[model samples]
Target: MTSLALGPATPAATPRAATPPHAATPSGAAVPVTPAAAATRRPSEGSVHSWDLSTGVDGPGTRFVTFLSGCPLTCLYCHNPDTWRMRNGRRTSAASVIAEAGKYVRFISASGGGATVSGGEPLLQPVFTGELLHRMKHELGLHTALDTSGFLGVRATDALLRDTDLVLLDIKSWDPDTYEKVTGRPLRPTLDFARRLADLGQEVHVRFVLVPGLTDDPADVEGVAAFAGGLGNVSRVDILPFHKLGEAKWQALAMPFALHDTPSPTPERIAEVREVFRAHGLNAV
Candidate 1:
């Protein structure tokens, strides 16, 4: 994810009750609240890594992007390694996140941008993610975008999709084995999500990180391009060149930087990849 301003973590808030309040039964006995009823009363909370302001790269104009914590896939080129664990993030409520974004509402709208709920993987906390999207769209009246790998796409409810104006879907790789090699997870879920988005006519920007020797194969790139093009809902394809910007973070976390020696794709290579997407009749940037 591209960011201009990296804000400090939001202060942790008081925790909620573990059990719901009991209801009085018709026989004058206290009855435990039903699971469904308790859910409605529970506040939306999630593990937040951090937030930042970015332009052009994240989505549309300038955006207030929230980076939620926890992800299923362990991508070789993940820049935010610190966000891999949910426990590493600060516990905060959805209202607090909205309040933070509300501070930049006018500025974001003026730039033709909106709010993006990104992650470690936003879908890791579907209820909280949905709350952020719904309030950001309905309350703030801003365009909403979800930046995700689509691995947990099944968790996103239709209500959440309805509130989302754009989706920055990262289709890391196309070939099943290659995808697994790049993300340490299967590719079926993401492809399934893409098809679902197409069926819903959802607007999407397919993001692909071009890494030399890893995902630079012409056949693999072609597969992604063809799939995104066939979706009919993908408005643009973003061919991002791999970089070692997160190398320092990995070292700080005491984790192996597997791609430490991997060189960024050359400008020529990047242009070639873009041309592949263009051949599919989709806009590439």
Candidate 2:
């Protein structure tokens, strides 16, 4: 689940022009639009990398996953290195994204799936993300999920969180040092976000990638499992085993793959890690 291949871009939806509330008077005088009304007419736009359909990996069922571009963390094992830069993405409006997702509303609804706003880091463009989530839930009549590292949790507004039905939070590592090593960032923010989600009673699925020699330490895994278990909002824990599916991506980007020599955890090791989560009274998979 840590690695998602970029899919084809959805056909562009025709951009709709915003209608100004102010009208011309018979005397040909124009009325000034209020600040609040102007804000409403402003379309939320973001840099979108790509989007794809996936089942069981993004959320509950098959989901219309939107992968926004740009991330603060340069994870050693990041698969989509192509999405690392915001400039690499195409500028897209939230309305266009919703229009694309709307096409599949009936199918997604029937399958018990919804829409997931994933990223290079969706929080990088919080305003656009919130718009997509809001429309996806209210307009599309679908469950909405946010796939985030939670590093930018502070950017998420309460209104944004209100629209999210579930959060697929990735706790790359539990130990602060290890977390920093795995992702060139601190761990406190993610933990803080988790706590906030717990307080808000937001549904969450904790995703942990088990990288050998880096994040495979039982204590570290236990640290994440324990923290997630303690958070009453965590509905399930996904023990994502590290894989080289994104190795070709790194090679294509000409970026050094630090874990090139590292091997994936065996089935038994994966099972063992899952047991650690189950021990903490969490539904681990």
Candidate 3:
């Protein structure tokens, strides 16, 4: 996704793919792959607090939402401004988080969906996410999923992917300029993340927010379609119609509303975006 500074979690804004059977191996020889730098980067010296786990239909069968704190991105429209501060929340050890998640093991077992480690950038706490996912999968037999921007480095990503069964990957914008404008981050990292996931043959659901004017450029949409379509492992593309539900969060945080007057896209625009995905032969969910 574009820079984290875009905004909070709203109805419209929220947060990948595979190759083939014999397609994995190269014809002649295989190029050795290395983990991403972000994965290897030293864990943030900051601590993490685990919020109470809850249920949701957002992803998987039933989600035990694990809200972790601390974020590096400054997306202006972020709804979870409360989660941005590194020191504002209480700390919970990885073991504690896993234990609590285990409490709902029955829920997960019955529903076929398990723990969802969310942000303020869950990848920021790679070790914690890895440990939690490991426990849930091996001990609890839970179906693990990651809700991430896919912008994290390979090192951290490798750890997180070890126990991850599915990924809810967000692609904020395809235009590098718009991506920088929205997230204050570069676009290549996110694209690289997607490519890496696809290369690994992971199950990914590509999500794009239909932000009026900002993310609606034909080139941008087409670019996203082209990228998602190229990934043989991508199961679906979800076009989320952007809404200002997080407008109140910006007020609560006293952040300026940069997208205040921007209304949700019309039915026609949503249809157009769906058509773009359909044209690419992607299942637009």
Candidate 4:
């Protein structure tokens, strides 16, 4: 679910969540809860692209995956380019989102799972994302995970991470030049955010997409593995093999398919990469 945006034609069926009484305004203003602000800051809505009641992939067990719209990065391998636009999604309230997750909380919790908010970078909508996670943890007592590219990690607040149980962080590349080439964004911000997450004792699962030539350089892989290992808080490293699944998405969107003809890595290649991570004493899969 990393590169080449999957502009799925699932129809705008998912609902978004809204603001909390104590939260700041959407413009980052500190406003008291007034009738006007309440209506404007309505806790009943968020910009949600789609959702899925998933298992295994999104998080630990059964999960309520809410994919929000809007992202800053234009990764060459983006799978959800459809999510690249901001607020181009259905608006639902916080209550509505929680309600949907509530329907599966029992099954999720029973299997040591919970809800994960992903998107074109969830941090782009920090207020909505934070509020939703807070409720998921405090109100429903469900484990919460955030799947993000970390490009907008600076927008994340302390309160938000407190509610997050785990982070599915996608580290696109190691070298600054290559990172920028892979994603139309810099790498330091992501590294800074990863460091911050580690400093907070938050659990993190490092997700790396292994592109055939772009990111297969041994130096790049070693750099990432070493850096991740030093963090101490990284629980797992998932070396995802590159695929053409999202090529159709790119073509459908009329976006250039740079890696259109790229082949997926073989099992041995993936294992070799996994071994690189393991060499750093990391748990790789």
Q: Per-residue lDDT of 93-137 in model 2, one digit per residue for the tens?
A: 777888888888898899899999998999888767877888898
Better of 1 and 3 by lDDT: 1
Error of 4 at 244 (Å): 1.4
Quote model 1's TM-score. Answer: 0.90
| Model 1 misplaced regions, further than 4 Å | 12-40
lDDT of 1 at 141: 90
User: Which segments of candidate 4 are over 4 A away from where they belong?
Assistant: 1-41
The global C-alpha lDDT for each of the candidates, from Candidate 1 onward, is 0.86, 0.85, 0.68, 0.81
Residues 15-45, model 3: lDDT tens digits:
1011111111222222233445334443222
Ten-residue segment with the worst summed lDDT in candidate 1?
A: 17-26
Candidate 3 lands at a TM-score of 0.79
Candidate 1, residues 176-226, lDDT tens digits: the string is 998999899999999998999999999999999999998999999999999
Q: Is 2 or 4 the stronger prediction by TM-score?
A: 2
TM-score of each: 0.90, 0.90, 0.79, 0.87
Best by lDDT: 1
